[model samples]
Target: MREHPRDPRAAVIEERIASRPQGSWFTDPDPLKAEGDVRAVIDAARAQGAMPVLVTYAVHHRDCSGHSTGDLTAYHDWIEGFARGI
Candidate 1:
């Protein structure tokens, strides 16, 4: 576990598990689809009297394989566009 400077009382835990025989698949989000897609979900939830939560996952060096990755500046710009679309 490791602690972050921004949250002194909070700790982050990371663990690796053994691989299973069954295979797994992964899909990445399309930034182009994010605006309308996210807004549609948020609108639906609002109509149902539910609050929506947004989580930002794009970060520099994410996945360590150049997949689903974005730099900080790009992240901020994308988020701005997403908010505008909402």
Candidate 2:
């Protein structure tokens, strides 16, 4: 948000957040579940005058089980098909 955008990370993060599929749940991990941890991340990011981003991930036990969205094809297919056209 700084003038002229010295922080390129801001634009990238914002665009990613905006382009994400609707109703998608992209929150910080459990360690960052605490208010203090989240605040620390945001505060550190803000010090650089950049936007903050919340990224999500899954353990994907199904990968080993060959059930969950295990591979790139499966991931891309699901993302395109189910992901609200994001």
Q: Which stretches of candidate 2 lie over 4 Å from their true place?
A: 1-33, 56-86
Model 1, residue 27: C-alpha shift (Å): 9.0
**Model 2 TM-score?**
0.28
Predicted candidate 2 versus true structure: per-residue lDDT over 57-79, tens digit per residue: 43233356555444565444433
Overall lDDT per candidate, in order of appearance: 0.53, 0.47
Tens-digit lDDT track for model 1 on 1-86?
A: 23455664333322122222222211224454556656776787679796665654544466767766666776666666566546
Clashing pairs in 1: none
Superposition TM-score, candidate 1 onto the true structure: 0.45
All-Cα superposition RMSD per candidate = 14.4, 13.1
Worst 10 residues of 1 by lDDT: 18-27
